[model samples]
Target: MRKLVIAISMLAFTGAAASADPIADRQALMKERGKLVGTLSKVVKGEQAFDAAAVLDALKGLEANAEKFDTEALFPVGSEQGRDTTAAPKIWEDKAGFNAAEDKFLADVKAAVAAPPADVDALKGPFGTIAKDCGACHQTYRIKKG
Candidate 1:
């Protein structure tokens, strides 16, 4: 029950307001996504003890962030032109492909949440998958920024 409650509130915790400036909103969410991934990375690296509950919470956070990704709202036309945005022009040109990438990422996240690892060693495979999923999206839809 408590985990479910945490998962529910994960949206608010990760949300950066999808109201006005979507570029900012998506950027903020991505930053939070990094933090969530970092938490799991630590566990996977053996830097943190494996606590199933903690892993589940982090997984839930990923799930929340993935589920909240409103592509249409966040990637609106002209949004790709924002100076502060790292989104690639292909995001606009290849909207369907971008949407497909996002769908795969969200599905992978939900799958991790559904069958969360019981230990740190068990987490490596899923963690690798999640990392690859993010990389795939960025490769196609994001522009590198210094």
Candidate 2:
């Protein structure tokens, strides 16, 4: 019963926290992706010992965010102007291209998740590919923060 109460409370808190602030919500989502990538990067760079479970979890998170990137609500109109968003105005200007970039990212993430690496060495290629996808999207759609 205690566990159930805690779980319910956490859910309620999360729901309230998410709110209607699309910029904040999307920023939070991107931060989560960054953290997952950082975790995998540590393993890849030999800063951390290879952990298959952790690698798989991070891949799953990346895949989930890739899917979320497609959701229209995640980038509501006018969301780019306010908040500390790195999203560039070009995203709204070139909506089709922005969505195409997201689609490519989703496909790359799906491929990585589908064949999770068994070791850090094995992860290097797919991880690099996903990183490239992120860079490509960021180059076109995201503004650099000063």
Candidate 3:
């Protein structure tokens, strides 16, 4: 009975938390996304001090943000109404592939961020590889809303 009560309380709490605040949520996500891209760009261009520790930290943040983008709450059903959302409908259809892409993106970014080039000046190869995964997913899943 105690366990059941705890579970019920947890579920209620989670349900309350799941209520969407679309604007704030999107803003927060976009902020993190921009930070991730900015950090990656700096490392790639040798503009920032390429500390492996710092890179790993940024990568972890990026991965967590990426995972959050996978949640249904963010892309709620029937949310395709005039919100500038770039998510294509095919994402739901190709759920497995979309999920796999997200997973691969996280893993690739993690590895690349964790094992960044010792010689920061010549980071073209590693950075380009990581960027490729991002582009690949965008090409398939993200809509070009021009």
Candidate 4:
């Protein structure tokens, strides 16, 4: 009886500590991405100094982080530590499509980041496309919290 109680307590504690909430985690990543977007925008719009090399550096971080959101990270269904999360319950029901969306978004960002525009004017179109893809994924997968 004492052993059972200890085991239950340990399981409960572990569950609470490890609830992944990937939706929340993704939102937090986006918040950081937002800052990068703003900085990129400033450079693109001619409002700030233009630095192609700096753009590349910032983009590398976004690319690395974004890669994590693919199939496993987003649909985290069978995971005990990770757990199914605030990402709409629909995600599990339609796994393939969700993963495809992630793949497309990842591919788009990779191409966009690989070749940043030369001047502010040139950056606008590509930046907009990149941001739009981000919006697309968020809209489909993320649940609005009230």
Backbone Cα, N, C clashes tallied per candidate: 0, 0, 0, 0
Alpha-carbon runs more than 4 Å astray in model 2: 1-17
lDDT of 4 by residue, 4-118 (tens): 4334434543443366655455545555566667777777777888776666655554565466454566346643224334466556777777787767767766887777667
The segments of candidate 3 whose C-alpha lies over 4 angstroms from its true place after superposition are: 1-19, 22-27, 113-117, 121-126
| Model 1 regions more than 4 Å off | 1-15
Ranking by TM-score: 1, 2, 3, 4
The per-residue C-alpha lDDT of model 4 at residue 58 equals 55
lDDT of 3 by residue, 1-146 (tens): 32443344345334544656543464456555666667868977768877765655555656556656644665555664446677778776787887788788777766765665565554556567667877887898778867
Q: Where does model 4 exceed 4 Å of error?
A: 1-28, 45-47, 78-86
In candidate 3, position 64 carries an lDDT of 57
**Candidate 1 C-alpha error for residue 68, in Å:** 0.6
Comparing 1 and 3 on TM-score, the stronger one: 1
TM-score of 2: 0.85
Error of 1 at 6 (Å): 4.8
Tens digit of per-residue lDDT, candidate 1, span 45-118: 88999999889888888887888789898888988785678899998999999889888888888888899899
Q: For each candidate, what is the lDDT? A: 0.82, 0.77, 0.63, 0.62
Task: Return the top candidate by TM-score.
Answer: 1
Question: Could you estimate the TM-score for every candidate?
Answer: 0.88, 0.85, 0.67, 0.65
